[model samples]
Target: MLDRDIAAFYGVETKRLNEKVKRNARRFPNDFMFQLTEQEWSLISSQFVMTSRMKRPKKSLPYAFTELGALMLSSVLRSPVADETSIKITRAFVAMRQMLTFSTLPEKVVTLAQELYKLKEEVNEILADQNDINESTRAQLDAISTALAELQASRSQDATLKNRRPIGFIQPKEDEE
Candidate 1:
């Protein structure tokens, strides 16, 4: 997670969050919190749409906080909101671990299964809508093709008519008339 996101979750300004983190730097090891490289930042920027205001010219890259670092932030911030948010974040992390390990509670497993079914149904509906769009697009393309062919034929006929000589004798130029 980026420090800014964690700050937002903790209900603090990003600069204030960084200041707290810096104050308690000993709590965050290099692995827990580290600055992103320019290359890494560029790659992330390419993958996501960043706001122009967020694009500041900084001497150093923004810091990335690992789960441990995020947890440590709650302790450093010293606010009730931070504490509650940290607990929720911690629970989320534990839930993710449980899901990955396949050690989810029975109730959680049932909920997950239901959610999966809902997702599957949604995907099927989207595919059906896409098929309808495909058919409509095909019809439109055929109409365009027919129109182009007609236009081309008309243009060819006009060209031939323009190039053809008159049935009678050639008319004199304006100067001769």
Candidate 2:
């Protein structure tokens, strides 16, 4: 199935759907999904005519995730459609895997495992980068909070000085008839 079709079933715009996957980040390991490099994109696009007529807003192409990636997505996003879609998609994947296992040459399993391992490494790197970014943001926020506290203290002192009133303003005065 095309990525676009699966994205639509989740009730999210394509970009938002991708972004959600990106945010969860860890749930998707490499076997589940990987970015399509230019060469890979060219190969995929040449082989498949599905996206040929569709007008894309950007020049850059999007990555395609395998069935495993789609299953990983359901773990992160909690929507009614996600549940149903996950079940259906997982079944399809299981059938495909079973077919591959039964029909494929025995020698291919080693190569497939090696590729899967590399993909998992890439997914781990993506999650690590996200964690680094979160850490940096937390540090920046802490610095900003410190600066704000200092500013607030200075402002409070100035306010006390400005707010002081002379005796005339506070003393009891007779109201003229």
* Residue-by-residue lDDT tens digits, candidate 1, 121-177: 999999999999999999999999999999999999999997776567776354366
Per-prediction TM-score to the true structure, in the order listed: 0.51, 0.50
Candidate 1, residue 147: the lDDT equals: 100
Best by TM-score: 1
> Where does the lowest 10-residue lDDT sum fall in candidate 1?
51-60
Clashes of 2: 0
lDDT of 2 by residue, 1-177 (tens): 445656877777777777787898787777777766677767767787575526544465665778878877787768888999899888987999998887766568878989999999999999999999999999999999999999999999999976665465554334432
Q: List the pairs of residues colliding in candidate 1.
A: none
Off-target runs (Cα >4 Å) in candidate 2 are 50-54, 57-59, 105-177
